[model samples]
Target: MKVKSATPVDIFSLTDQGDALAVRLQMLMPGASRHHRPKPFIEIAQSSFRSGHRCIFICSTGIVIRALAPVLRDKYRDPAVIVIDQSGNYVIPLLSGHEGGAVAFAHDIAQAISAQCVVTSAMDYSRPIYTIGMGCERGCPLAFLQPLFEQVCREMDAAVTDSAVTDSAVTYSGLASIDLKADEAGLLELSKSLNLELHLFSAIELRQVEHLLSEKSEIVFKEVGCYGVAEAAALCCATKLTGMPAELALPKQKNARATIAVARSYAP
Candidate 1:
């Protein structure tokens, strides 16, 4: 899979460590333009906000709040505001969480840097959304796929157990897979059993997010024309469902007959 074109971003950093992390993020998010301790920080922030650029501030939450306060408008009109600590340990959606798409944006940044997203919006508490991606041999049976799906869901639950928000009632919104698997009986059965819609993506669509995969397989590419099936499909499906980019909640896990992965998105 090939990378997508970069999206525009404005990144502000306070300290040397923050600047360094900013540089790394700039590389990851190719559209980012960095500002390292500008003389009048508030003015620059206001400019960015007025211009409607998504902003990321690698400083204390207070600094960002103060700088953007004057330009703050209603959530429907405000640009996304994200705050990250100097160490890049946490990514928080400080403003316009739902209307401005900051919650989903924060999740994407956090996943790219392996940071934890600290989303405190009340909307997030209402059932978390997840999509499961799977790939299996031609004749794989539901008996084999069902247990693997359960195991991966358990894995997802365990992974988020220590996070800031732990929703025990997380919703498995759908199942995703390559178009080749659309006719697979096991997948059809699993979709029926779970009462979840099945989403299938072409290999070309899956390739767009190939850069985000944690693990890629040459063998899989040789067979499917994409580096991975489970992870790419899960991410593609989640992005489609939420109308926002998604992050892998769990990387690809495999058993004898099938492979599974999970992706998450916060709907705006």
Candidate 2:
């Protein structure tokens, strides 16, 4: 089968380890802007950070990677970053390798380009699971949040919920009530909240859940796919509350969605 064309929202300079790999990547993501070297890399990084791009692709050498790491960490809300060889032959998912989806992106790209994507996150490697968070910056709109999470309660009947971030600011454009069926991760702070749950599930396990949910036709998200920003919010809340390292669960495919959720323990 031909490689599926995937475009990076923001693509930085690439070494062109060789024309073959570079060309393959172009084919994968036809819309991604290209450059000869890493010159525009820094410029794009800076602009994309302030503009709220949560995911960035840095294709360069170890030196560039070192320089770009802190730049991304400091400026952006810890975007989902991917570092692939110029040849697109060897790919490395530096930060948020697992949760952020760097590994998945690399793997998918490698498959399309017929290259090698090296993804070895301890959690993913051991359990082979994929976690999805559900939310925007503060959270997703009540319209979507209400239905998606409510379904979980309708079927499960009883589920334990808590708010890890006590009084965590959950901003909403309209007036809403915290009529959740489950417990909050920390406390009932946000009047408008979601009926969400977090769990450390193996990708294999998630597939099962998706399949089971699909068979039963309980989840309306069959057409929405298993992974989305809403799923990212669930994963983010679950991991953040449980004191697990999983901030990279969602990619900043869009802006202010560029926002990051800091663990209450770590937040000021």
Candidate 3:
């Protein structure tokens, strides 16, 4: 599946405490909108839902539930719903646990606020979100690059299974590269084959992550204004997924036509 980017969040608050929490959320989540004491709470939530925004109610569950009852839709179609107390003591994911990432989002927010996260999803634990970054010559064949991904995943899976981190399986969240390769044929085909989203970052974004890479290349810097595409993209994507800088699980490995790197997130 093409995992979508984080959704725009709409936080509704009516009291001083709730408004304070909303301010914190604005800082924590980019593009998060705060609505303080809207006249009709239900209408505001419905509008946000219809517009594909995640709805977070910093009020009593009963009140939000009653207001959202009429707007409730299928889990896949409905926006994520989270409820938090005014004092920020408890954080609850009320709807769309996995499909909407309410559980994960709640955990991140709870951790930021030092509140207790109450996740009810069956598989509630957060795992590392691994990302693969690749750089290849124009028109490189998928046949040449496909086997490399399989090999990398096999090696990383073995390493993760042997580690003390949770025994749960590891999976690639997406593929990333420098913006120049946004339309590269081989990269697009590789992403399609793996059923993962492809994110392209600007040279500046990639350069910002150069310090985190296991290896840096002067040749690559002269060519693309960055030290390394594969390692830089992997580290950059990992940081985007998690709110912290990521560690390189596997440094850049290359064939005659392509280079690949892998990075994984640490749980917040």
Candidate 4:
């Protein structure tokens, strides 16, 4: 008898068993070209989050997810994450979609692979809120968010505190919109109502994007790592409303990729 080599598998199946194969095919397909075909996973995830891909499947072993996780917008980061076992079984819920379908995904994979489903934190925690506010606009990290927690405190002080508020005050704006790590009902709704955003703390500053959202020649939104999300938000909000960035007029950042981040969040 001949012995065969072992194939690398997701074990947990964060990438859908089929999803990973699909992603790989897209790359190998002959018709798919750079200008015509969609961008690769990293760029696609970022762009998808920016362009409003609520759920994304990452094929490669969670490296992309880990890398981008730190630099994505909080409110905007609700793409359901699943890890798929290469053998088409053992799907695992790595993050997102608490009450939504992610649990179903895990169960489906478990049933198929005859593997165990492990759900911690999200499933057990009755109330775990993640507030993904906007990025700080100055040239430094989005450290301004920590102090803004006082805003939430003030709301609590005013007795307007909500039962939904469950700590985890994370912000992300300099990063991509897809880094949203909370359930859609939690972070997405809060951002819409609170008029807030979330982002990460990045080495690439935000001096230029400030000039766009300016007031009378003086830059108003002047905080560090603030421009990327602002611009992306402008683009996304526009896309949702009409599917075009022309009306939003969000100025393009020089380093479009560097605009993403991961930070504590708050709303004002």
Top lDDT: which candidate number?
A: 1
Clashes of 1: 0
TM-score, cand. 4: 0.29
Give lDDT tens digits, candidate 3, residues 189-256: 98998898898999999987664565678888888889999988887887788775465667788888
Residue 220 lDDT (model 4): 27
lDDT of all predictions, in order shown?
Answer: 0.80, 0.38, 0.77, 0.34
- Better-scoring candidate (lDDT), 2 or 3: 3
Best by TM-score: 1
* Candidate order (TM-score): 1, 3, 2, 4
Per-residue lDDT tens digits for candidate 2, residues 1-268, read: 2322122345554444544455555554546544445555566565654443323354555644665655564311344566666655676766655434455555555665566767666543321212333333234443444454334333222211111112222321111111231243221222334322333333332332221110222232343233332333433344444444333322222223221211111111
Mark the 10 consecutive residues where model 2 has the least summed lDDT.
Answer: 259-268
lDDT tens readout by residue for model 4, 121-190 = 3333222122222322323222343334344344332321211122333222222242332333333443
Question: Looking at model 3, how many pairs of residues clash?
Answer: 0
Candidate with better TM-score, 3 vs 4: 3
Which 10 successive residues of model 3 have the least lDDT summed?
1-10
Question: Per-residue CA lDDT of candidate 1, range 1-268, in tens?
Answer: 1111122579999999999999888886656789999878889888988877889999999988888888887875677799999999999999878655577678767877888999897766233468999999899999899999988777666545534344354568889999999899999999999999899999999998785576779999999999999999998998898876566667788899999988776665
What ranges in model 4 sit over 4 Å off? 1-39, 52-61, 75-77, 99-101, 108-116, 122-268
Work out the TM-score per prediction: 0.58, 0.44, 0.53, 0.29
